[model samples]
Target: MARTVTPEIVAHVKRFEGCKLFAYPDPGSVNGEPWTIGYGHTSDSFLKVRKGMTITQAQADAALEHDLNEVADAVERLVKVHLTDNQFGALVSFAFNVGNKAFANSSLLKKLNAGNYDAVPAELARWNKNDGKVMKGLTNRRAAEAGLWAKGSFVASNTVEAAPGNPIKDLTKPETITAAGGLLSGAAALATGSPAIQIAVGICLVVAVGVIAFLVIRKATR
Candidate 1:
Protein backbone atom coordinates (compact mmCIF):
# COMPACT_ATOMS: atom_id res chain seq x y z
CA MET A 1 0.00 0.00 0.00
CA ALA A 2 1.16 3.55 -0.67
CA ARG A 3 2.13 5.63 2.35
CA THR A 4 -0.07 8.58 3.21
CA VAL A 5 1.28 12.09 3.63
CA THR A 6 -0.16 13.76 6.71
CA PRO A 7 -1.96 17.10 6.76
CA GLU A 8 0.22 18.35 9.61
CA ILE A 9 3.16 18.59 7.23
CA VAL A 10 1.02 20.31 4.57
CA ALA A 11 -0.28 22.80 7.12
CA HIS A 12 3.22 23.56 8.26
CA VAL A 13 4.35 24.22 4.67
CA LYS A 14 1.41 26.59 4.02
CA ARG A 15 2.04 28.49 7.26
CA PHE A 16 5.76 28.73 6.54
CA GLU A 17 4.89 30.23 3.15
CA GLY A 18 3.05 33.04 5.06
CA CYS A 19 -0.54 32.04 4.17
CA LYS A 20 -3.16 32.63 6.79
CA LEU A 21 -4.99 29.43 7.85
CA PHE A 22 -7.40 30.75 10.47
CA ALA A 23 -8.46 34.11 11.80
CA TYR A 24 -6.13 33.53 14.72
CA PRO A 25 -3.25 35.96 15.14
CA ASP A 26 -1.08 36.14 12.02
CA PRO A 27 1.31 33.19 11.87
CA GLY A 28 3.68 35.06 14.19
CA SER A 29 1.56 38.17 14.66
CA VAL A 30 0.51 36.99 18.14
CA ASN A 31 -1.91 39.92 18.15
CA GLY A 32 -3.44 40.40 14.69
CA GLU A 33 -7.11 39.66 13.90
CA PRO A 34 -8.34 36.15 12.98
CA TRP A 35 -7.66 35.87 9.27
CA THR A 36 -7.17 32.47 7.59
CA ILE A 37 -8.34 28.86 8.02
CA GLY A 38 -8.49 25.09 7.02
CA TYR A 39 -5.65 22.68 6.05
CA GLY A 40 -4.88 25.69 3.92
CA HIS A 41 -4.12 29.28 4.88
CA THR A 42 -7.47 30.42 3.49
CA SER A 43 -7.69 34.22 3.69
CA ASP A 44 -11.40 34.69 2.99
CA SER A 45 -12.57 33.83 6.48
CA PHE A 46 -14.96 36.71 6.85
CA LEU A 47 -17.33 35.68 4.04
CA LYS A 48 -20.06 34.89 6.64
CA VAL A 49 -21.20 31.91 4.61
CA ARG A 50 -18.88 29.43 6.32
CA LYS A 51 -17.95 31.41 9.40
CA GLY A 52 -14.83 30.24 11.27
CA MET A 53 -13.84 30.53 14.86
CA THR A 54 -10.58 31.70 16.39
CA ILE A 55 -8.65 28.59 17.38
CA THR A 56 -5.82 27.67 19.67
CA GLN A 57 -2.81 25.84 18.26
CA ALA A 58 -4.16 22.66 19.79
CA GLN A 59 -7.48 23.10 17.98
CA ALA A 60 -5.90 24.04 14.67
CA ASP A 61 -3.56 21.06 14.81
CA ALA A 62 -6.44 18.71 15.52
CA ALA A 63 -8.49 20.16 12.65
CA LEU A 64 -5.57 19.66 10.30
CA GLU A 65 -5.31 15.98 11.22
CA HIS A 66 -9.03 15.53 10.70
CA ASP A 67 -9.12 17.36 7.36
CA LEU A 68 -6.30 15.31 5.84
CA ASN A 69 -8.55 12.35 5.05
CA GLU A 70 -11.12 14.55 3.33
CA VAL A 71 -8.43 16.29 1.28
CA ALA A 72 -6.72 13.04 0.33
CA ASP A 73 -9.99 11.53 -0.87
CA ALA A 74 -10.69 14.55 -3.02
CA VAL A 75 -7.24 14.30 -4.63
CA GLU A 76 -7.70 10.62 -5.37
CA ARG A 77 -10.77 11.27 -7.49
CA LEU A 78 -9.47 14.51 -9.05
CA VAL A 79 -6.18 13.06 -10.28
CA LYS A 80 -5.88 10.83 -13.35
CA VAL A 81 -3.83 8.27 -11.46
CA HIS A 82 -1.84 7.90 -8.31
CA LEU A 83 0.14 10.96 -7.22
CA THR A 84 3.39 11.10 -5.30
CA ASP A 85 3.10 11.95 -1.61
CA ASN A 86 4.26 15.46 -2.33
CA GLN A 87 1.84 15.87 -5.20
CA PHE A 88 -0.99 14.55 -3.10
CA GLY A 89 -0.10 16.89 -0.28
CA ALA A 90 0.25 19.93 -2.54
CA LEU A 91 -3.15 19.51 -4.20
CA VAL A 92 -4.73 18.67 -0.91
CA SER A 93 -3.33 21.92 0.46
CA PHE A 94 -4.74 23.75 -2.55
CA ALA A 95 -8.14 22.16 -2.02
CA PHE A 96 -7.97 22.95 1.67
CA ASN A 97 -7.53 26.62 0.94
CA VAL A 98 -9.70 26.98 -2.14
CA GLY A 99 -12.47 24.48 -1.21
CA ASN A 100 -13.38 21.17 -2.86
CA LYS A 101 -15.76 22.72 -5.39
CA ALA A 102 -13.11 25.16 -6.54
CA PHE A 103 -10.76 22.22 -7.01
CA ALA A 104 -13.49 20.39 -8.93
CA ASN A 105 -13.88 23.26 -11.38
CA SER A 106 -10.24 24.29 -11.53
CA SER A 107 -8.59 24.25 -14.93
CA LEU A 108 -5.65 22.55 -13.24
CA LEU A 109 -7.78 19.69 -11.89
CA LYS A 110 -9.77 19.40 -15.09
CA LYS A 111 -6.56 19.06 -17.05
CA LEU A 112 -5.28 16.42 -14.66
CA ASN A 113 -8.54 14.50 -14.55
CA ALA A 114 -8.67 14.47 -18.34
CA GLY A 115 -5.06 13.19 -18.36
CA ASN A 116 -4.01 16.26 -20.29
CA TYR A 117 -0.94 16.54 -18.09
CA ASP A 118 0.93 18.83 -20.45
CA ALA A 119 -1.36 21.74 -19.61
CA VAL A 120 -0.95 21.49 -15.86
CA PRO A 121 1.67 24.23 -15.55
CA ALA A 122 -0.51 26.79 -17.30
CA GLU A 123 -3.27 25.91 -14.90
CA LEU A 124 -0.75 26.21 -12.09
CA ALA A 125 0.23 29.63 -13.38
CA ARG A 126 -3.40 30.71 -13.39
CA TRP A 127 -3.42 30.49 -9.62
CA ASN A 128 -0.47 32.85 -9.51
CA LYS A 129 -2.61 35.76 -8.44
CA ASN A 130 -5.40 36.95 -6.24
CA ASP A 131 -7.43 40.10 -7.14
CA GLY A 132 -6.25 39.64 -10.74
CA LYS A 133 -2.68 40.72 -10.07
CA VAL A 134 0.50 38.71 -9.46
CA MET A 135 1.85 38.55 -5.95
CA LYS A 136 4.83 36.94 -4.28
CA GLY A 137 2.64 34.68 -2.16
CA LEU A 138 0.68 33.23 -5.10
CA THR A 139 3.85 32.96 -7.14
CA ASN A 140 5.47 30.82 -4.46
CA ARG A 141 2.35 28.69 -4.14
CA ARG A 142 2.23 28.15 -7.91
CA ALA A 143 5.90 27.17 -7.90
CA ALA A 144 5.25 24.59 -5.19
CA GLU A 145 2.23 23.20 -7.07
CA ALA A 146 4.17 23.01 -10.32
CA GLY A 147 6.88 21.00 -8.61
CA LEU A 148 4.25 18.57 -7.34
CA TRP A 149 2.54 18.32 -10.72
CA ALA A 150 5.87 17.41 -12.31
CA LYS A 151 6.56 14.78 -9.69
CA GLY A 152 3.25 12.93 -10.13
CA SER A 153 3.07 10.13 -12.69
CA PHE A 154 -0.09 8.83 -14.33
CA VAL A 155 -0.93 5.25 -15.33
CA ALA A 156 -4.16 3.57 -16.31
CA SER A 157 -6.30 2.66 -13.32
CA ASN A 158 -6.12 -1.04 -14.26
CA THR A 159 -3.69 -1.17 -17.19
CA VAL A 160 0.00 -0.18 -17.39
CA GLU A 161 0.31 2.82 -19.69
CA ALA A 162 2.31 5.97 -18.90
CA ALA A 163 0.36 9.21 -19.16
CA PRO A 164 2.41 11.62 -21.28
CA GLY A 165 4.10 14.91 -20.34
CA ASN A 166 7.37 15.84 -18.65
CA PRO A 167 7.47 19.43 -17.42
CA ILE A 168 11.20 19.37 -16.78
CA LYS A 169 11.89 18.16 -20.31
CA ASP A 170 9.45 20.70 -21.70
CA LEU A 171 11.32 23.48 -19.87
CA THR A 172 14.83 22.53 -21.02
CA LYS A 173 14.57 24.35 -24.35
CA PRO A 174 15.39 28.07 -24.28
CA GLU A 175 12.61 30.49 -25.08
CA THR A 176 12.59 31.94 -28.59
CA ILE A 177 12.54 35.72 -29.01
CA THR A 178 10.75 36.71 -32.22
CA ALA A 179 10.78 40.48 -31.82
CA ALA A 180 13.18 43.04 -30.27
CA GLY A 181 13.65 46.84 -30.16
CA GLY A 182 15.68 49.69 -28.57
CA LEU A 183 15.45 52.57 -26.07
CA LEU A 184 12.83 55.36 -26.08
CA SER A 185 13.43 58.75 -27.79
CA GLY A 186 14.58 61.74 -25.69
CA ALA A 187 16.12 59.38 -23.18
CA ALA A 188 19.63 60.08 -24.47
CA ALA A 189 20.42 62.85 -21.99
CA LEU A 190 20.28 60.29 -19.15
CA ALA A 191 22.76 58.18 -21.11
CA THR A 192 26.55 58.58 -20.81
CA GLY A 193 28.37 59.81 -23.93
CA SER A 194 31.95 60.98 -24.49
CA PRO A 195 30.86 64.61 -24.04
CA ALA A 196 28.05 63.87 -21.60
CA ILE A 197 30.35 61.64 -19.58
CA GLN A 198 32.96 64.43 -19.37
CA ILE A 199 30.30 66.90 -18.31
CA ALA A 200 29.05 64.51 -15.60
CA VAL A 201 32.63 63.90 -14.50
CA GLY A 202 33.27 67.66 -14.33
CA ILE A 203 30.11 68.16 -12.28
CA CYS A 204 31.31 65.59 -9.73
CA LEU A 205 34.77 67.22 -9.58
CA VAL A 206 33.22 70.70 -9.03
CA VAL A 207 30.97 69.35 -6.26
CA ALA A 208 33.99 67.76 -4.59
CA VAL A 209 35.94 71.06 -4.88
CA GLY A 210 33.09 73.01 -3.31
CA VAL A 211 32.90 70.58 -0.37
CA ILE A 212 36.67 70.75 0.16
CA ALA A 213 36.66 74.56 0.00
CA PHE A 214 33.85 74.78 2.55
CA LEU A 215 35.68 72.44 4.95
CA VAL A 216 38.95 74.36 4.56
CA ILE A 217 37.16 77.69 5.11
CA ARG A 218 35.48 76.33 8.19
CA LYS A 219 38.85 75.19 9.58
CA ALA A 220 40.47 78.56 8.86
CA THR A 221 37.57 80.44 10.47
CA ARG A 222 37.77 78.22 13.54
Candidate 2:
Protein backbone atom coordinates (compact mmCIF):
# COMPACT_ATOMS: atom_id res chain seq x y z
CA MET A 1 0.00 0.00 0.00
CA ALA A 2 1.07 3.58 -0.62
CA ARG A 3 2.46 5.20 2.48
CA THR A 4 0.67 8.06 4.23
CA VAL A 5 0.83 10.01 7.48
CA THR A 6 -0.58 8.10 10.43
CA PRO A 7 -2.40 9.40 13.52
CA GLU A 8 0.81 8.80 15.49
CA ILE A 9 2.58 11.41 13.40
CA VAL A 10 -0.37 13.79 13.60
CA ALA A 11 -0.39 13.47 17.37
CA HIS A 12 3.38 14.07 17.41
CA VAL A 13 3.04 17.32 15.48
CA LYS A 14 0.10 18.47 17.58
CA ARG A 15 2.09 17.82 20.76
CA PHE A 16 4.45 20.63 19.74
CA GLU A 17 2.34 22.98 17.60
CA GLY A 18 -0.42 24.00 19.96
CA CYS A 19 -3.76 25.24 18.65
CA LYS A 20 -4.48 28.93 18.83
CA LEU A 21 -7.95 30.21 17.99
CA PHE A 22 -6.62 33.70 17.29
CA ALA A 23 -3.87 34.40 14.79
CA TYR A 24 -0.56 35.19 16.38
CA PRO A 25 2.85 36.36 15.21
CA ASP A 26 5.06 33.46 14.21
CA PRO A 27 7.75 33.23 16.85
CA GLY A 28 10.06 31.35 14.50
CA SER A 29 9.51 33.91 11.74
CA VAL A 30 12.56 36.19 11.53
CA ASN A 31 10.83 38.86 9.43
CA GLY A 32 7.37 38.83 11.07
CA GLU A 33 5.90 38.14 7.66
CA PRO A 34 3.36 35.35 8.25
CA TRP A 35 0.83 35.16 11.04
CA THR A 36 -0.01 31.69 12.40
CA ILE A 37 -2.97 29.91 13.91
CA GLY A 38 -4.44 26.46 14.58
CA TYR A 39 -1.59 24.09 15.28
CA GLY A 40 1.24 26.03 13.61
CA HIS A 41 -0.72 26.69 10.43
CA THR A 42 0.00 29.98 8.63
CA SER A 43 -1.57 31.90 5.73
CA ASP A 44 0.46 29.70 3.39
CA SER A 45 -1.25 26.63 4.79
CA PHE A 46 -4.72 28.19 5.20
CA LEU A 47 -5.49 31.37 3.29
CA LYS A 48 -8.03 32.50 5.89
CA VAL A 49 -5.29 33.00 8.51
CA ARG A 50 -4.63 36.69 9.11
CA LYS A 51 -4.12 39.20 11.87
CA GLY A 52 -7.14 39.72 14.18
CA MET A 53 -8.86 36.68 12.70
CA THR A 54 -10.45 34.06 14.95
CA ILE A 55 -11.52 30.52 14.04
CA THR A 56 -13.78 27.88 15.49
CA GLN A 57 -12.41 24.51 16.67
CA ALA A 58 -13.81 22.88 13.55
CA GLN A 59 -12.00 25.36 11.33
CA ALA A 60 -8.76 24.73 13.17
CA ASP A 61 -9.16 20.97 12.68
CA ALA A 62 -9.95 21.53 9.00
CA ALA A 63 -6.80 23.61 8.57
CA LEU A 64 -4.68 20.88 10.19
CA GLU A 65 -6.18 18.30 7.86
CA HIS A 66 -5.52 20.51 4.83
CA ASP A 67 -1.94 21.21 5.86
CA LEU A 68 -1.14 17.55 6.63
CA ASN A 69 -2.45 16.44 3.22
CA GLU A 70 -0.38 19.10 1.46
CA VAL A 71 2.74 18.01 3.31
CA ALA A 72 2.07 14.33 2.69
CA ASP A 73 1.58 14.96 -1.03
CA ALA A 74 4.79 16.91 -1.17
CA VAL A 75 6.65 14.09 0.63
CA GLU A 76 5.29 11.47 -1.76
CA ARG A 77 6.19 13.58 -4.80
CA LEU A 78 9.74 14.45 -3.82
CA VAL A 79 11.07 11.25 -2.26
CA LYS A 80 12.12 8.47 -4.62
CA VAL A 81 12.72 5.70 -2.10
CA HIS A 82 10.07 3.31 -0.81
CA LEU A 83 9.05 4.19 2.77
CA THR A 84 7.11 2.40 5.43
CA ASP A 85 4.08 4.15 6.90
CA ASN A 86 6.05 5.25 9.94
CA GLN A 87 8.89 6.55 7.80
CA PHE A 88 6.52 8.42 5.53
CA GLY A 89 4.76 9.87 8.55
CA ALA A 90 8.06 10.94 10.07
CA LEU A 91 9.16 12.66 6.89
CA VAL A 92 5.76 14.31 6.47
CA SER A 93 5.95 15.71 9.97
CA PHE A 94 9.49 16.93 9.33
CA ALA A 95 8.56 18.48 6.02
CA PHE A 96 5.51 20.08 7.57
CA ASN A 97 7.62 21.63 10.32
CA VAL A 98 10.63 22.68 8.15
CA GLY A 99 8.77 23.45 4.90
CA ASN A 100 8.95 21.51 1.62
CA LYS A 101 11.64 23.61 0.02
CA ALA A 102 14.07 23.12 2.88
CA PHE A 103 13.27 19.42 3.07
CA ALA A 104 13.74 18.99 -0.67
CA ASN A 105 17.18 20.63 -0.52
CA SER A 106 18.38 18.99 2.70
CA SER A 107 21.17 16.41 2.89
CA LEU A 108 18.72 14.10 4.61
CA LEU A 109 16.69 13.84 1.43
CA LYS A 110 19.88 13.44 -0.61
CA LYS A 111 21.21 10.69 1.62
CA LEU A 112 17.84 9.00 1.80
CA ASN A 113 17.40 8.99 -1.97
CA ALA A 114 20.97 7.79 -2.53
CA GLY A 115 20.20 4.57 -0.59
CA ASN A 116 22.10 5.46 2.57
CA TYR A 117 19.06 4.69 4.68
CA ASP A 118 21.11 4.31 7.85
CA ALA A 119 22.02 8.01 7.71
CA VAL A 120 18.36 9.08 7.90
CA PRO A 121 18.02 9.34 11.66
CA ALA A 122 21.33 11.18 12.07
CA GLU A 123 20.57 13.54 9.22
CA LEU A 124 17.13 14.17 10.63
CA ALA A 125 18.67 14.91 14.01
CA ARG A 126 20.97 17.51 12.47
CA TRP A 127 17.96 19.61 11.59
CA ASN A 128 17.43 20.57 15.21
CA LYS A 129 18.82 24.02 14.58
CA ASN A 130 16.70 26.95 13.45
CA ASP A 131 18.36 30.04 11.93
CA GLY A 132 21.81 28.84 13.09
CA LYS A 133 20.67 28.37 16.69
CA VAL A 134 19.44 25.15 18.27
CA MET A 135 16.03 25.44 19.82
CA LYS A 136 15.11 22.99 22.62
CA GLY A 137 11.73 22.32 21.07
CA LEU A 138 13.36 21.66 17.72
CA THR A 139 15.86 19.35 19.41
CA ASN A 140 13.02 17.40 21.01
CA ARG A 141 11.08 17.26 17.76
CA ARG A 142 14.08 15.98 15.85
CA ALA A 143 14.67 13.31 18.46
CA ALA A 144 11.08 12.16 18.06
CA GLU A 145 11.49 12.11 14.29
CA ALA A 146 14.64 10.04 14.61
CA GLY A 147 12.75 7.58 16.77
CA LEU A 148 9.96 7.42 14.22
CA TRP A 149 12.42 6.77 11.42
CA ALA A 150 13.88 3.86 13.34
CA LYS A 151 10.56 2.43 14.51
CA GLY A 152 8.81 0.04 12.11
CA SER A 153 5.13 -0.13 11.20
CA PHE A 154 2.29 -1.08 13.55
CA VAL A 155 -1.50 -1.51 13.40
CA ALA A 156 -3.89 0.88 11.69
CA SER A 157 -4.74 4.03 13.64
CA ASN A 158 -8.54 3.84 13.43
CA THR A 159 -8.74 0.31 14.82
CA VAL A 160 -10.81 0.67 17.97
CA GLU A 161 -10.21 -2.16 20.40
CA ALA A 162 -11.23 -2.54 24.01
CA ALA A 163 -8.92 -4.14 26.56
CA PRO A 164 -10.11 -7.24 28.42
CA GLY A 165 -12.44 -6.50 31.36
CA ASN A 166 -12.28 -2.74 30.93
CA PRO A 167 -15.10 -0.85 32.63
CA ILE A 168 -15.00 2.31 30.49
CA LYS A 169 -15.87 1.63 26.85
CA ASP A 170 -16.18 3.43 23.58
CA LEU A 171 -19.65 4.94 23.07
CA THR A 172 -19.69 4.04 19.38
CA LYS A 173 -19.46 0.32 20.17
CA PRO A 174 -22.62 -1.55 19.07
CA GLU A 175 -23.35 -2.97 22.50
CA THR A 176 -23.04 0.45 24.16
CA ILE A 177 -25.37 2.07 21.65
CA THR A 178 -27.92 -0.75 21.97
CA ALA A 179 -27.89 -0.58 25.76
CA ALA A 180 -28.15 3.21 25.85
CA GLY A 181 -30.95 3.20 23.29
CA GLY A 182 -32.92 0.60 25.30
CA LEU A 183 -32.72 2.73 28.46
CA LEU A 184 -33.68 5.89 26.60
CA SER A 185 -36.63 4.19 24.92
CA GLY A 186 -37.87 2.74 28.24
CA ALA A 187 -37.62 6.18 29.91
CA ALA A 188 -39.49 7.77 26.99
CA ALA A 189 -42.24 5.14 27.28
CA LEU A 190 -42.59 5.82 31.02
CA ALA A 191 -42.72 9.64 30.65
CA THR A 192 -46.40 9.86 29.58
CA GLY A 193 -47.04 13.18 31.39
CA SER A 194 -44.79 15.66 29.49
CA PRO A 195 -45.08 16.05 25.73
CA ALA A 196 -41.88 18.15 25.72
CA ILE A 197 -39.90 15.43 27.50
CA GLN A 198 -41.23 12.86 25.05
CA ILE A 199 -40.06 14.97 22.13
CA ALA A 200 -36.58 15.21 23.61
CA VAL A 201 -36.62 11.49 24.26
CA GLY A 202 -37.69 10.86 20.67
CA ILE A 203 -34.74 12.88 19.39
CA CYS A 204 -32.37 10.87 21.60
CA LEU A 205 -33.90 7.62 20.36
CA VAL A 206 -33.43 8.71 16.74
CA VAL A 207 -29.80 9.58 17.38
CA ALA A 208 -29.23 6.22 19.11
CA VAL A 209 -30.84 4.32 16.24
CA GLY A 210 -28.70 6.24 13.76
CA VAL A 211 -25.59 5.33 15.73
CA ILE A 212 -26.50 1.64 15.79
CA ALA A 213 -27.21 1.66 12.04
CA PHE A 214 -23.92 3.40 11.35
CA LEU A 215 -22.05 0.75 13.36
CA VAL A 216 -23.72 -2.03 11.41
CA ILE A 217 -22.88 -0.42 8.08
CA ARG A 218 -19.30 0.26 9.10
CA LYS A 219 -18.81 -3.34 10.20
CA ALA A 220 -20.27 -4.75 6.99
CA THR A 221 -18.07 -2.55 4.85
CA ARG A 222 -14.96 -3.52 6.81
TM-score of every prediction relative to native: 0.49, 0.64
| Candidate 1 clashing pairs, residues 3+ apart or interchain | 20-41, 21-36, 21-37, 22-36, 22-37, 23-34, 23-35
lDDT of 1 by residue, 1-222 (tens): 334656544654546443234454434333464344543333332232123555555555545555655666777776776566766777776776566888888888877777776676677777766667787877877777667656645436556664555444333323311110112122244345687775775576567546654554554455
TM-score of 2: 0.64
State the lDDT at 222 in candidate 1: 53
lDDT of 1 at 84: 62
Q: Write one digit per residue (lDDT tens) for candidate 2, span 107-212.
A: 9999999988788888888888877999899889988988888787443435775333322344466787678767776976767858888778778777876776
**Could you say which candidate leads in TM-score?**
2
Task: Name model 2 segments beyond 4 Å from true.
Answer: 1-3, 44-46, 153-222
In order, the Cα lDDT scores of the candidates are 0.57, 0.81
Residue 6 of model 2 has an lDDT of 76
Candidate 2 weakest lDDT stretch, 10 residues: 162-171
